[model samples]
Target: MISQYLGIIHPLFPVPSSSVKTGFTTSISAGDKLPQIQILPLLDEVLGVHRVNNRTTHQLTVPPSADDDHAQAWEAFFPEGCINPGNKVAPMGGFGFFMKGPNDFATELGKATSTHVLFNYEVLFESEWEWRKGGKLPGIFGGAGDAAYTCTGGRQSDGKCFNLRLMWRENGKGELYAYLPLTSSNTEHLLSVPPRSIQHPDYGFSVGRGAFTFVPGRWTTIAERIKLNTIGYEDGEIEVFIDGKSVILATGLILRDSTAIESRVRGLHFQTFFGGHAPEWASPKTQRAWFTNVSGAILTDERGIHRDEL
Candidate 1:
């Protein structure tokens, strides 16, 4: 019934609760968990974000808390379905924040669903293994030429340095692919890591597979530049920027005829299977960096954002 499935729950991600209650069908719940995914640090608020037919919408905020393990709100669509298809996990379409299921929930999440993953992380070196939670295989596999930790040395680029990446799902066979431009910054060079296979030697912090590395601090504004129009099909653009400088940029990047920097960009999104810099392949330095304020929309079909929007 589709090109392929990525998740089990048709998640209405980052939505706030209509009422303060833990209901799978409701956004609110009496459980411990990180604030709803749509946590806007700057707004001092939370939001419930969902999608339908691929269009994204925003809802009220679920109050904030110092907890990340919020509870599961909905009943099982199928207890039998619990054995989530790893490669394509289900997205909880509509549910209030629920109660936490168990202590090792992300472990459980890895088991029940979301196995199809491409690993990338910051460390002294990259590995040639897959990510496993509890000695069990995940639904996802990995990529090639792991981006290891730079030699405490350093790197520099001309004009500007940027971080670039590509986010794509694999075919059932588990090969690599991309559907969008992940990053297109120009200043990433100043930060140490620049475009392409080369990397910076200094130790820094990064998140979401280490592509969005920044100063050891929280980001004031996190935004992406994009336009969803072009001559061919699936035309779009995305420039990941921190503060206001662009990290990843690709013009006419998404049309049918364009080719891109694959391995380097993929390096950004690839997580670590072999624990390197961060514990268990996480960047120990990343958390020390802060992500305080947050305000970015979920644009599904917009061509571009205003200057202020970025």
Candidate 2:
């Protein structure tokens, strides 16, 4: 299990479909299986593929291209604007996903020491990754929704949650953010200044064992890994992969401290360019690229790599 998680959870080819519904009335439940990226079809499948389901009076929504992950996800989450006058399909956008069960959910369960939080997600985007707050669970976008659900939810003492989002922007930059619950307060990012202001400081996404890079317009994959065990301070590491090439590495995020933000794993979130509202999360606007085979694995232990490989 650790081998696959530490390494990568690559999808063989096509992903299975998840049967999901709309509205906040129904619950995902422990036994209820789900489709990836919301919607009804394509549930439980790997993300990035596009699908269309125009079952309304107004057909403003257009089915996403079979390969346009970014467009597909973005549209699924915010399908309201993806349509036209009557009930038509809108243009392609991005892709988003929601996982109900733990594909190894217990690995990070419990305290894992001083309030730990982690995040992981993957999606395909189009030319642009937009950042806005129009569509989300009430107050999450700043303009409305519960900020706690979108921001503090990760560090909440509750059970667990996961969110994944894909954005379609006009510029070359698009944004995406995933949340992993940790024990603590969201003061730093929730109460910091610009350039230095960071929201959800207590949360972070993995970059394939804390290293990776994702670019725009290209069909790439993002690998995220998070490990935390500390006292006054928690470690936040991220890695990115652009076109299968390593690109970014950020460490020492300082998300947990006995003096401040410290909590336990509650849930995870995925967003598109959260802007300044999202603390601790520096959503790179330029990461508006496409990715496929969105899968994951968890690694527990390992030995030193062969020095010659270096």
Candidate 3:
């Protein structure tokens, strides 16, 4: 099947592992090469998190380090087919803790510099996760944006942060999209890249849009490179690649006002759930997703954009 879609392979992507080892699958063999990227400041291997729904019976466990490359490799399960009875309107799939500021995401990629962050995502099984309820799609915020978790200091509203999200569209297609939130006073701007063609008076702007077919039960690498816009000028830029394919290349974006605080690459927001305050968005059944090679770094030059050495 992979060879059938050989044309889609990005010239720079490494040959994907024919088989992956997970909690549900066998372990990675010693012969398999581990992901090797140069991240400056690394976060905790055990990403300690605060649960949103303490009563929810979701499970998050780290696989055996000997069986995997990264000691912190994590797998999250969302039951066979369960819904949050307490909050039916918004079903909460377990989420990892949100990391903020330099203390947590303390990297040389300071608040004012342009940087690139990289990570890998794979679905453990075929999960029809998107229910298409409440007008919002069902997915998870695995990447970090410049938004705040609480309404204090740098964080203001839901649309105030810039992050990457893995979403399942209403059609059941997997999507890798960028979510950039900018707000001031009463006006709010929510933007998306790759699906960037969407335009509305209230939804702000969705610029350079593109799509990729996520091969279920396979590994997909995501790389995000962003250059903060110069206030008052549409000079901002964002580029995204899925398995090395350039899915979105957007520019002329006005990210923030001149007086607004500088938004830096904080860390992973790690939000996963069904939302929109509607029943349609609920998971039809319990589903599970796995993530690994979760790492990032600053782009010092052009070579900084490549993935793990093949």
lDDT of 1 by residue, 197-236 (tens): 2222342122122343322111122333333323234443
Ranking by TM-score: 3, 2, 1
Every candidate's CA RMSD: 18.1, 12.2, 8.7
lDDT of 2 by residue, 199-310 (tens): 4344433212212223333444443333332445444433333333333333444333443233333333332222223322233332332222333322232222112221
Model 3: per-residue Cα lDDT over 156-241, one tens digit each: 23434454445444554444344444433212222434343443343333343336545445455554445555556655555555
Comparing 1 and 2 on lDDT, the stronger one: 2
As a whole number from 0 to 100, the lDDT of residue 57 in candidate 3 is: 32
Against the true structure, what is each candidate's TM-score? 0.27, 0.40, 0.60
lDDT scores in order: 0.22, 0.29, 0.40
Better of 1 and 3 by lDDT: 3
Model 3: per-residue Cα lDDT at residue 185: 23
For model 1 the TM-score comes to 0.27
What ranges in model 2 sit over 4 Å off?
1-122, 126-170, 174-218, 233-235, 259-267, 272-292, 301-310
The TM-score obtained by model 2 is 0.40
